[model samples]
Target: MLILGQSPTDAPVGTFGLVNLLAFLCIVPLTVLFAPVGASLAAKLDANRLKKVFAVVLLITGVRMLAQLLL
Candidate 1:
């Protein structure tokens, strides 16, 4: 986003800062609500199982991003 703002465009440079601030503001409340649930889930899940799940999720997300670009 910062790089895009740096390019020749109509967008104001402060747009990056605005986006970052908005993202932070939006995430803080969600973190507060979900962190406890995540922590509890982590406690229940085996470490190896969590690692595998995280890896698969990341792979799927990467594939989805690539597909988006291709499509």
Candidate 2:
């Protein structure tokens, strides 16, 4: 991916860190803007069904984390 005497990683550490920080910074506002919209959509769906699905997913994640910790 190098051209014109430049590879992407040739960028300075500070420059790369700043770019990454800015990218994450942008996600904050986006989450704030979309939170209410996503909440409304989920609310319109069958709440009980969604809750059951979410509970199963959470249980699986918790089990996996515990297994990893025990190992």
Candidate 3:
């Protein structure tokens, strides 16, 4: 929604400006190179383990957001 709501001329927030675009461009090649490796590793992981890992990631992300809000 943020992307759709934003106009081209809108001031860039830290994640949505020209600098971020350049950074994304720079990382695209690396992402392309490593994504398949990541996919293979994920594919090898058991479904239950993957779900637990994903849950932990989400839990950590939620805690970080809560910390930021409190701080």
Best by TM-score: 1
Sorted on lDDT, highest at the top, how do the candidates line up?
3, 1, 2
Candidate 3 clash pair list: none
Candidate 3: where are CA atoms >4 Å away? 1-19
lDDT of candidate 3 over 1-71, digit per residue (tens): 45445445765554563345666778999999999987997999999998898899999999999999999
Question: What overall lDDT, based on C-alpha atoms, would model 3 receive against the true structure?
Answer: 0.79
lDDT of 1 by residue, 1-71 (tens): 55344433554443453255556678899999999998998899999999988899999999999999999
Q: In model 2, what is the error at residue 69, expressed in angstroms?
A: 1.0
TM-score of every candidate: 0.64, 0.43, 0.61
The Cα error of candidate 2 at residue 12, in Å, is 19
Q: Native-vs-model 2 lDDT?
A: 0.73
What stretches of model 2 exceed 4 Å from their correct place?
A: 1-41
- 1-71 in candidate 2: lDDT tens per residue? 12234335766443343254455568889999999987887888798988987899899999999999999
**Candidate 1: lDDT of 19?**
53
**Higher-scoring candidate on TM-score, 1 or 2:** 1
Of the candidates shown, which would achieve the greatest lDDT relative to the real structure? 3
| Candidate lDDT (C-alpha), each | 0.77, 0.73, 0.79
